[model samples]
Target: MTELNISTTAGVFDATAAGPAEGRPVLLLHGFPQTRLAWDRQITALAAHGYRVVAPDQRGYSPGARPERPDDYRISLLVDDVLAITEELGWTTFDLVGHDWGGAVAWWTADAHPGRIRTLTVVSTPHPGALADALRTDEDQRARSHYMLDWRETPKTENDMLADGADSLRALYAGKVPQASADAYIRQLSQPGALTAALNWYRSGRPRHAIGTIDVPTLYIWSTDDAAFGPAAAQGTEQWVNAPYRFEALRGISHWIPEEAPETLNRLLIEHLQTHEEH
Candidate 1:
């Protein structure tokens, strides 16, 4: 993989790319507490399949890209950052895939700027509307998402997560994320201002938005055992997608769907991309 620094309206974003320079571009966005390296496996596989994959340490995660004000990390700004990076790379339109918080951003980007996205694949996150609905009506979802309250209200959420050598953060990924990857995530979150900036994603705006229907072909992957989201939220996602959509529930899997099931995720993504092309 080649490391790159792309200029965006917010700042310079650290990115990684692979595959032929002229191949179809696929932008992969990572979730909270994780870096672009989270997509390392899929990046290699997709590149081998003739895709030019670009993964960026988005917004707050990238040292130079992080903003001081919480408002700067709003979803609109996050979407703009992705578009700016894509424009910087001369890609007017590209396929998008995101996991966790990245998935939320991807959904918003595809919905608000349909012209910039050709296809969308999201892992382990529900559509905004679905999330909003769940947060309001689903007691289980609200209970599961209790951590968000702490993240938003507590002043020391970051320090507490990082203290004790990030033992709590590491535990969240136990049995799901590989040891090396988990350590890398902890190290990234440990960086000065990194965790705070990331948490800003949750704090910058309303916790959820009314579900907006997306017109682009899309795929939603949810694990049966994801702790952060409940089945109601996952199943209700289809209501907000007006375009062709596929929902896959990986039984017995945890929230780390891409990492825990890389091959399955890669196959699904490749199939969706190829099927979209054929259609």
Candidate 2:
């Protein structure tokens, strides 16, 4: 894997590039409180499979890319960060993969730049519209998402996440990610201003307008143990895709699908990419 510092309009983002340069490009985006390191397992797998994988320490997560203002972390700008990374790589179009908050940005990216994404693979996050609907009408979803509200409303969210030697943060990935992987995430977010920037993603609030149907061939994966998202939203995702779509549900896995279940994730990703390989 090659670690690179990519310059974008926002700032320089730290990223990792792997696989043969001439291979099909695949852009991977990670979620809140974690850097591109979150893709460690899958990146190696995809690269070995001959996919050019580019995973970025998305805006706010990278020190140079961190913007102080909460608005800077809005959905559009988050999507722009992905676009800028792809542009920097000279990829006009690529297979897209995202997890957690990264999955949210991936959804908006596919919606806004339909032609630029050849295939969309979202892990553990549902379509914005489906999530919004769940938040608005489903009591269970509302309860499940209480952490988001706390992150948005409480000024101490950062401290709370970092206190007790980041015990709170460690709990998030209990059985989901190995200790080393969880430690890596904690170390990144534990940096000064890192936790704040990550929290800004939540403080930025939901998208003003819903991200609608994606036209590209898409794959959505969800684990039954995810605490933040529930079954209703996951099941409701089918309604938002206008093209070929496949859904895979992992009965016992947790929200940290990429880390907890890399083999399964890689198999699904490889199949999805091959099935929709651009001729």
Candidate 3:
């Protein structure tokens, strides 16, 4: 795999690129508090399968792309970064994959620009609308998502996340994230203004409404043990996609699906990508 600084009108994003240049283009987005390295395992696998993949550090995570204002971290702007990065890469239509917060942005992007997305693969995050529905009806999801509210309300979210050699932050990876990977993530976010910039994603309040139906072929994977999203959200996601859709639930896997379950994740991702031809 190769690391690159991709420059767009909005900003320069640090990303990891793999596979052949002439191969099918696939853009991957990482979630909060993690960098493109979160997709390292999948990146190598996808590249070996001849899919050109780019996983950007994303808006807040990329030093050059980090913006201070919470409003700047809105989903719309994050979607903008996805499109801009693809445009810079000269991709007319590409497969899209995202995890966690990245999955949220992926849903919005596919909904807003289905023509540009050939296929969509998301891990752990359901459609915004489906999740909204679940949040309203499912107490389990609400209880699981309490941290989002707590992060936004607490004045020292950053201090707490970064204190004591970032023990609090380090603890987030107890769900089997490789110690080396977690250490790198902590070091990246521990940079000046980086943790706050990443936290701004939580600070940017949810959209008052849900995202529209996504028309592209979509594959949604959720681990049963995920603390953030419950069965209500995962099962509700099928109704949000108007095209060929598939959902897989991994038993006992945590919120960190990609890292905890790379073999399964990679197999599912490869199958999903192979089943759909690029538009």
Per-residue lDDT over 172-256 for candidate 2, one digit per residue giving the tens place of the 0 to 100 score: 8866777887888899888888888898988986677767788989999999998889999999999999999999999988899
lDDT of all predictions:
0.90, 0.90, 0.91
Q: Provide the TM-score for each candidate, comma-separated.
A: 0.97, 0.98, 0.97
Assess candidate 3 and give its lDDT: 0.91
- Model 3, residue 103: what's the lDDT? 95
Report the number of the highest-lDDT candidate.
3
Q: Residue pairs in steric clash, candidate 3?
A: none
Tell me, what's the RMSD of every candidate?
1.4, 1.1, 1.2
Candidate 1, 1-279: lDDT as tens digits: 999999876899999999999999999999987999899999999999999999999999999998877888888788888889999999988999999999998999998889889999999999988988999999999999999878885458876787889887788886689999998888888888888888998889763455379999999999999999999999999999989999999999999887999999999999999988743
Per-residue error for 182 in candidate 2, Å, reads 1.3
When 2 and 3 are scored with lDDT, the better candidate is: 3
- For model 2 the TM-score comes to 0.98
Q: Which 10 consecutive residues of model 2 have the lowest summed lDDT?
A: 152-161
Q: Model 3 off-target regions past 4 Å?
A: none
